[model samples]
Target: MSRPPRILDGGTGTGLQEAGIAIAEPWLTSAALRDEAGVAALLGVHTGFLRSGSDVLTANTFRTNTRALARMGVAEADRPGYVRRAVDCAVAARAAAGTPHALVAASVAPVEDCYTPSLTPDDDALRREHRWMAGVLADSETDLVLVETQCTRREAVIAVEAAVERGLTAWVSFVVTGAAQLPDGDSLREAARACVEAGAAAVSANCFPHAAVPRALDQLGGLGAAVGVYPNLEDRAALDEWEHSAHSLPPALTPEAFAGLARRWSAEYELAFVGGCCGTGPAHIGALAGLPVGAAS
Candidate 1:
């Protein structure tokens, strides 16, 4: 029988620090542009994951959009360079891995800050940011553009449109409510339908509780495209508080424990891809390697 689909690793920011980088504010991807050494440090973490047997390496451009940068005092003129640096960092990481092949993904975050769908920006703003990010990813050698943590239907569809316009394959992964539903409280069945209709090459639920993941997958069953999953292992209450406070310190999850959960879910769904979010790191992903992918006891 064929081997199971691989597990993708999670957030690179903290992993970069653990891999040894002096990051003052990890939230801004533009920090890489300001300090080449810092950028290199982050890229090194990507290499570490690749070396650790991860099949995918997501570029560290999550939250590098102009809107988020402006909040960090970055000027409009520097946005393009910021975006470019994000891609270059990933490229450098891939090269350092010495691997013959790996899927380098450009991570496109929610147009509006996640967990605050009411803050969803206007279409003009969303389109401009999405198009700019997608265009940059398109120009680079990225294998895929993964738009993640979408909190609303509108933002997810717009991201798909941006990717399609740029002739890139898009993956839309949403952040769902703790109740095992999409942010809008819609069923995943409905969410999957909408994502496929909007041109997503894959559909997933990311940055959610581990317990909720299998339910989310069940709700999304039967979408024609590949079904992926990357659940977070943090305490649900801690995540809610962090979202409310806009804090940067991520919660933690033991790799061994999360791996068991991932293995069980992966077996049941034969998931196309799986990984951790937020608190997940290399250890978590490493534990996922070689796990059975379909119909576990």
Candidate 2:
């Protein structure tokens, strides 16, 4: 029998912001590691997702890389500590939630803005930065490395290769401009294939509007690797929009509606996992967990 899909947790940075945490640019969710209250809030967010039956809890290391930290004015000496703290919060939250089997994935984002492919660093910078970030995740004992929201194929390949070189199980995810198209206008099929060839155990399309996921998944099929999606809570009308204005508009789907869509995606695509991106919360995950296992058919 086919295995049930794993439920990845919803948006970490957005969830933190919803929880009243001040996550500024250059630090993002990583800034939540600065104090006891922030740490407690982080743990609460993780435990909430765990209670909602998430199988994977991604650490808030999205902006802990050297390039991001340098922009935040953090000294080189204190950078690793920030990354470790992000991992530690996830580990501690897993322990607190009493779920020993849930995986803690380190978030390996692009060296620059995830949406602006033109701002991507040179090939050397990509390799060097991803190598350093992957080394830290391995050293921190992350359950896996999630190279997510990559706008370019080269960055995804380099990041996946770096994680695999450190003996980490890496899953790479991309952001798309449209169905089967990367934000940089590359074919998603080609990018997914490249990452798979570079040692990615899974390939996914993420952080795009919900309407685009099915077509993206269609292109992702037959890659010989597990496929998944975690789309942002944007409606079909926002398909061409990259920037999220979630605060100004109501959510595109209620928790129940989101769960219903996830069920359809799971059954139709045989998705290895289904989860949310921006604007999702524990309630959305809880709804997903309530769906019958092996619902895919």
For lDDT, the strongest prediction is 2
- The alpha-carbon RMSD values of the candidates against the true structure, listed in the order shown, are 4.3, 3.5
Give the clash total for candidate 2. Answer: 0
lDDT of each: 0.74, 0.86
Best by the TM-score measure: 2
TM-score: model 1 vs. ground truth: 0.88
Off by over 4 Å in 1: 1-3, 17-30, 235-253, 290-297
- Model 2 scores a C-alpha lDDT of 0.86
Our model 2 lands, by Cα RMSD against the true structure, at 3.5
1-297 in candidate 2: lDDT tens per residue?
198799999878777787788666656777688788888888888888887889899998988898999888989988888899999999998899888999999999999989999999999999999898987888895899999999999999999999999999999999986565987789999999999999999999888878888889989989989999999874536444765443323458888889999989999999988899877777888889894433221
lDDT of 1 by residue, 1-297 (tens): 156776687757557545554445445444555786877677767776776667878887787776777777878888767777877877787788786577878888885577777889888889888888887778887888888988888888888889989999988888886677766676767766787898898889988777778778887668887888987665546444325322234455566677787778777887778888766666667667743332111
Off by over 4 Å in 2: 234-240, 244-250, 291-297
